[model samples]
Target chain A: MTENNYIYAPSEHPADKFRCKVPMKGTRQLFVIDGGVQGTAAPLSIKFDEGNCSDEILQVIGVRTSSGPKELSSESSFSFGQNSQGRLILCSHTFAEDPFITKEKIKISLAPNSSVDIVLMQNEHNDAEHISEFEIDIQRDASLRMVFLTLHGGKISNNIKVNLNGENASCDLNGLYIVDGKQQVRNLVSMNHKDPHCYSSQLFKGILDDASVASFSGLIHVWPDAQKTQAYQENHNLLLTKEAKVYSEPQLEIYADDVKCSHGATNGRLDENELFYLRSRGIPKKEAQLLQQQAFAYAVLDKISSEELKERMVSLTEQRLRGEFSKCKNCCKNCC
Target chain B: MLNIKDLHASIGEKEILKGINLQVKPGEIHAIMGPNGSGKSTLSSVLAGRDTYTVTSGEIEFEGKNILELSPEERSIAGIFLGFQYPIEIPGVTNVNFMRTAVNEHRKAKGLEPLNAAAFLKIMREKMEVVEMNPSFSSRGVNVGFSGGEKKRNEIFQMAMLEPKLAILDETDSGLDVDALRIVATGVNKLKRPDNATIVITHYQRLLDYIVPDIVHILYNGQIIKTAGKELALEVEKRGYDWLING
Candidate 1:
C-alpha cells in the first residue's frame, strides 16, 4: 500500500520518460513492466482483490523494452463493482531509438449502475512500433466515456471494441491523433449494441502533415433484439500537405428496424475562405493556419469531463500543432 | 487617403473592373452604388487585396505608397479594413481571441506594445457596445450561429475595434434590418475621425440615409458613369438607375 502525493518512477526506469503532467490529489500511479505486474516490486504497486473499489483515479504507466530477444507484450484487466464510479488514465511511452515492437491488451468491465471515464495516451519515438487492443464491456445502466489521444508515434495501431450488453447502457468514445514525418497511425473501433434502449456515439479526428498517413475504420453493429437503439459515428481528417494521406471508413450494420444509426467521414484541407478571412483581419498566415488547426483539434479535446486535464491537454495539443514536438530527442526543455 | 487609377482587374480571364478610377480623402465618406454584377464587390475585393482578383494594370496607392504587392494581412495592418458582406463563421476561435490577435498585430506594426488581457477586454467591451452587441457575444465563436443582422453588426463592431484609416463596407446593409442598419451606421459614424475615411459600397440608397456620403458614384459595367453630391442618391432612389444611365 504505497500512497504518496506524487509518485515518480525510479530515474533509471524507462517509465520515467512518460511526459504527461500528473494531476494532484487522490491518484494511484503505478508502473508496469513486460506485460506483467510481477516484473518490478516497486513502492507504487498495489495488489487488487475482487472487492477493491475506490472513487480515486487509477493512473497506470507502462513502458516496453526491446533490449531482449523475445517480443515485448503487456496484458492488464480492470473491473468495477456495481454503483461505483472511477477514472482511469493509461499512458504508454517508448524511448527506444532502435527498431522496437510491443503489443498491449487491456480489458475493462463495468457492472450494473457503475460508470467509468478512461483516457489512453500513446506517445512513442519514431522508430518504435506498437499495437494496443482495448475490449470494454458495459452492463445494465452503466456508462463509459473514453478518449484516445495519440500524440506522437510510429506505426501505431489501436483496436478498440466496446459492447453494450445490458439495457440503458451508453458509451461515448472520442479520439484525436496528430502525426507527421512519415509516421503512420491507425484506429479500428467496433461498437456493439446487444441490448434494447442502448446508445453509443463516437467522434475521431486527425491532422496529418508531411508524409504521414492515418487510417480510421469504425463500425456500429446493432443486434436484432436491440430495439430502440441509437448510435452515431464520425471521423474527420485534415491533410496539411499533398504527401499526407488519410483513409476513413465508417460503417453501420443494423438488424433492428426501429433503431437510429448514422456515420460520416470527411478528409479535407484547411478551408481557404476561412484562412483568407483570418488573414484579412491582420493575423499572420502562419498564425492563422495554426489557429485553424487548433480549432479543428479542440472539438475532440473538449470532450474531456475534467477541466484540469482538459486544459492541460489543450496546451499540449497546441504545442504539438506548433511543431514543438518535432525534435523531441535533443530538446532539454520539460514542456510537460 | 486612398487613390485608385485605371484599376483594371480581372478574375482569371474575365475582366471585372475595367479602368476604374476613384479618389477618397480623409474625413470623407464616399458611396458607390450600382446594380448587381456591376463589379461593386469586385472593387472592394481588389482594394482589400483579395488574391482571387488580379490587377491586370493600374496601381492602388494608400498614403503615398503603392500597395499592389502587399498581402491581405499587410493591407489590414496598414490600416485598410473591408467589412465582409457575409462574415465568415469560425467555430472555435472566439471573437475576443480573433480581435485580440488582429489588434495586437496592428499594434506591433506601429512599434507599440501589445495590449494585455485586461486592457484588451476593456477595449473589446467598449467597442462591442458601439454595435449594441451583448457582452456574451465576445466569448462566442466569431459569428458562429449569429443571425444575419448579428453578423453585419459584428462586422461593424470589428471595424470599430480596428479603427482603420480606410474602411470599406461592401454590401453590409443587404441583410440587416432597419434597426440593425441604424446600429451599424451609427457605429461607423461614431468611429469617423478627421484622419480616417470610409467607402460604402451598396446597391440601395436606403443606407445613405443614415450615413450620408459627401460624394456619390454610380457605377455601371465596371465604370463610374456618374459622380455627384448626396442628392444623386435621392434621385437614383426615385427615378432608378435607368434614368441616369439613359440621360
Candidate 2:
C-alpha cells in the first residue's frame, strides 16, 4: 500500500513533489484526501485497475494548495462491466513567478461506461502557464465534462484531446477566461468521434482589456461511421480596450452524412447601454464596471460543482480584478 | 432645502440648462414642466451633479451649501438624490445590497453608525411597503428585469431607503401607468416631512394631480419662463406650454 496517499509537508522544497505510494492492487475502496500547507510543491499520481474497480468504486480526487503549482497526473486502462467517476479541484493559489512549470498529463482508457469531471481554476497572479494535457478514450455509453475557469493568468494554453472510440459517447467542454493588462491566453481543444451516435459541444468566452489577447481554437472530427453525430462549438470575446485582441477558430470535419454541427464566434466590447444603465444608478464608473465584470465571469464560476472551489475562484477573481496582489498585505483577510 | 440661481449647464459644448433659476423650501414640492428639449431632465441632472452635464456657471445650494462642488456620491451623502429619468439596471447585485450600501454610505458620512444586517433588512422591508414593491425584488439585482412602472417604483423605493433630505424625481412619471404613477407618488408623499423636500421634474400635470407641488415652473429655451401656484400645472395641461411661453 502507498503510504504517501495522505501526507503534509512544510514550504521548504524549491519544487515540492509527491507520488502516490499506494501499490497497484486496484482495490474498490473510497479515498478522501485534503490539501497541505500553502507554499509547498506536491505532485500527485493515481492509478486503478481497468476491469475490476471500474464497476464498484467511484474515485474522487481533490487538490487545494497555496503552493506555487500543484501537479496531478492520472493514468487508467480500459474497463467494462462497472461504472467509475473521478473529479479534480485546484484552489487558493499564489502562483510561483513561474508556477505550473512541472509537466503533467492524464491518460484514460475507458471500457464501456465511465465518466470524469476535470475542473482547473487559476485565480492567482496572471503570469503563469498551465501546461497540461488530457487524453481520453471514450468507450460506448461513456461521458466526460471539462469545465475550466481562468479568471486570472498572464499567459496560458490548455490542450485537451478526447477520442470517442465507441458508439453513444458524449463530451462537453465549457470555459470562461477573463484577461486584463496585456495578458495572453490560448485554449486549443480537439475531439474525434470515431463511432456512431457520438456527441460533443464546446463553449468558450473571454473578456480582454489593456492590450490583452486571447485565442480559442477548436476542432471536431466525425468519422465516416459516426452517424447521427451532433457537434457544436462557440467562442465569444469582449474586448474592453481598443488594443485588446481576440482570435477564434472553430474547425469542424465530418465524414458522416447524417449529422448536426454548428460553430459561431463573437468578439466585442461590453454593452454601452448596460454601462450607461449602471452609471445612472449613482454607481461610479469603476465600481459599475467591476459589478458588470463580476456578473459576466460569475456565469462560469457558478458551474463549478464544488462549493469550496467555487468560493475560492470567486475570491481570486475579485482580487485579480481589483489588482489586490499589487497591494498584497501579509494577512489579507478582507480579500473575501 | 434646495436653491438654483441662474443655473447654466450643458452636455458637451451645447447648452442644455441655460440661465435657470429656482428655489425650494423644506416640505414644499416644485415640479418643472417642459417639452422634450426644454431641459426638464437637465435641471435634475445638474442638481444631482451628473458628470456628463458641465455646469458652466451655476450655483446650487442644498441646505445653504454649494452642492455643485460636490461629487455625485458626495452630493448623495449630503442628502441629494436623483430619481433618474431612466433608472439604470445593474445585474447580479441585489437591490437590497445596493440600497444598503447607499444607505450605509450616507450614514457613514453623517457620522452615524452603519446598520447591521438585521436592522438593514428591517428597514428595507419597511421601504418596500412605501412603493408597494415585492419583498423578492430586493433580492434581485438593482432595477434588473423590473417592468417600466416597477423600475419607477424601485427608484422611489431607493429614495425611501436612503431618506435623503432633497429628492429630485427626474420624470419619474414617465413610462409609468396610472396605477404605478399613484403608487410612486404615494411613496414620495409618504416620505415627505417638514425637514425634507422634493423636486418633481415632469412634462405633464398627471403626476402633479396625485402629489400636488407647491409651485409649477415652465422651462423653455433652457430657462424658467413662468412660475405659478399648483393651479398653473392644470393650466399648462389644459392649454399646453405654447399658451404660457408665447404669452
Candidate 3:
C-alpha cells in the first residue's frame, strides 16, 4: 500500500519530498489513531459492521480538533459491511503560515446492500498546502455519496478514483471550491464502470477571486461489458476578477451500447439578470452576491445526509465566502 | 407620490425614452400602454435604476428624493419595486430564504429590527395566498422550473412580500392566462393603499379590466402622446394604437 500510494516522481514533484517527510516542524500533521502527536505510528483503520452506530462514534472521529492551528501526515483506510450506515468526516486545516501538508489516501470498499457518506473538508491556512488522494471501490447493491469542499487553502489538490467493480453499484461525487488571493486548487476525478447496470455522477463548481487559480478534470469510462450504465458529469466555474483563471475538462469514453451518458462544462462571471433580480428585491450589492453564491454552493453542501454535518458545512462555507476567515485577528484558531 | 419630469433615457447610445412626463399619486393606479418598442418597458427599467439604461436627461423623484442618483438596490430599499417582464431563475435558492434576506435588508435600511423566523414565515404564508402560490414554493428555488404564468405570478408575489411604496408592473399580463391574470391583478389591487401607488405597463387592455387604472397614457415613440381615463384603454383596444400613433 505504501509503495503504490506514496511513490511520486521526485524529478517532477520536488515538493512531494517536503510533504512526504515525517516528524517535521513547520508542518501541520494529520491526526492519527491512538494520539496525533508527532512521531505517532497510529493510523485509523475502521471497518464498520451492522449495528446501531450513533453520532457519538462520528463525534469521536474528531470533527472538532483542539484549539490552535495543527498539521499532520496520514494514511487512513475505511470500509463498511453489508447493511452498515454511518458518516465519516475528514478535515484538513491549519491556523497560521506553518504549512499543513497532508498526503491522504482513503480506500473505501462497501459490501452489497450498504451505503456511507463522506465529507472531505479541505480548509487549510493561507500559507498551507494539502494533497489528498482517494481510491474507492463499490460492490453490488452498494452506493456512496462523497462531498469535497475546498474553502481556504494556499495550494490544494484532490485526486479521486472510483471503480464500480460489481453489478448495480452507484456513486455520487459532488464538490465546491471557492478560492481567493494567490491560492490554487485542483481536482481530478476518474470513475470506471466495470459491471452492468452501474451509475456514476459528478458535479464540481468553483468561484475564483483576485489572482486565484482552479482546475477541474473529470473522466468517466464505461467498459464494453458495462451495459445499461448511466453516467453524468458537469463542472461550472465563476471568475470574480480579471486575473482569476480556471481550466475545466470533462472527458468520457464508452465502449458499450445501450448506455445513458452526458457531460457539460461552463465558466463565466455571475449572471447579470440574476444579479439585477436580487438587487431589485432590495438586497445590497454585496449581500446579493453572497446570497447567490450561497445558492450556487448549496447544490454540493446539501447532498450530505447528516443534518449536523450539513449545518456545520454550511456555516463553514458561509464564513469562508463572507471573508471572515481572511481576518487574522478574528480567525478563531479552534474553528473547524 | 412618484413623479417623472422630462425623462430622457438611453441604452448603449440608443435613445429609448425621449422626454417623457408622468405623475402618480398615492392610492392611484396609472396604466401606460403602447405598441411594441414604444418605450413602455424602458420606463419601468429607468424607474428601477437598472444600470443598463442611462438617464441621459431626466428626473425621477420617489418620496421626495432624486431616485436617479440611487443604485438599483437603494431604490428598492427606498420602497420602489419593479415587477420584471421575465423573472430571473436562480437555482438552489429557496423562495423563503431569498425573501427573508430581501425583507431583512429593507428593514435594516429603514432602521427597523429584522423580523424573526416565525414572524417572517407567517407573513410569507399569508402573502402566498394573494397570488395563489403553493405553500411548497417557499422551499423551492426562486422561479426555477416555473411556467410562464407562474413566473409572472411569482413577481407579483415578491411585490406582495416587499410591500413597496411605488410598484411598477412591466408587461405583467403578457404571458399570463385569464385565471392567472385575475389572480395577479387581484394581488396588485389588494396591496394598494392610500399611502402607496402603482404603475401598470402593458401592451393590451386585458389587465386593466381587473386592476382598473384611474388614468391611461399612450406612450408612442418614447413620449406619452396622449393621456386620458379608463375609457381611453377601451378605445385603444378597440381601435388599436395605429390611430393614437397616427394622430
TM-score of chain B of each: 0.98, 0.97, 0.98
- Listed per candidate, the RMSD to the true structure in angstroms reads 3.5, 6.5, 7.2
Better of 1 and 2 by TM-score: 1
How closely does chain A match the true chain A in each prediction, as TM-score?
0.87, 0.73, 0.82
Most TM-score-accurate candidate: 1
Q: Give the TM-score of candidate 2.
A: 0.78
Please provide, for model 2 over B1-247, each residue's C-alpha lDDT reduced to its tens digit, 9 standing for 90 to 100.
6788888998988998889888889888888888889998778777766678898997988889898877677777778788887787767667876766667666777789989999999989988999898899988877888999999999898888878888989999999989999999999999999999888999899999998999888889898999999998998888998876788
Q: Is candidate 1 or candidate 3 better by lDDT?
A: 1
Q: Which segments of model 1 are wrong by more than 4 Å? A: A1-28, A33-56, A64-70, A326-336
Q: Candidates ranked by TM-score, best first?
A: 1, 3, 2
Instruction: Give all TM-scores, in the order shown.
Output: 0.92, 0.78, 0.89
* Residue lDDT tens for model 1, A1-336: 123323444434455343324443566555555454423433222322334456677777665555432466666677766777778777776644667777877788888888888887777788777898889899999899999989888889999999999999999999999999999999999999999999999999999999999999999999999999999999999999999999999888999999988999999999988898899889999999998998899889988877766776787788888887632233333312
lDDT of 1 by residue, B55-144 (tens): 999989999999999999999999999999888999888899899999999999999999999999999999989999999999998899
Model 3 DockQ vs. reference: 0.78
Model 3 per-residue lDDT tens digits across residues A1-336:
122322221323233112222211221223432223222334556667654243432321222133324454566777777777656666655534654555666778887867777777776677677777888988898899988888888889899999998999999999999999999999999999999999999999998989999999999999999999999999999898999999998899999998999999999987888998999999888988988888888888988776756776787788888986732233344432
Model 3 per-residue lDDT tens digits across residues B5-102? 99999999899999999999988999999999999988998888889988999798887778888988999988899999999999978899899999
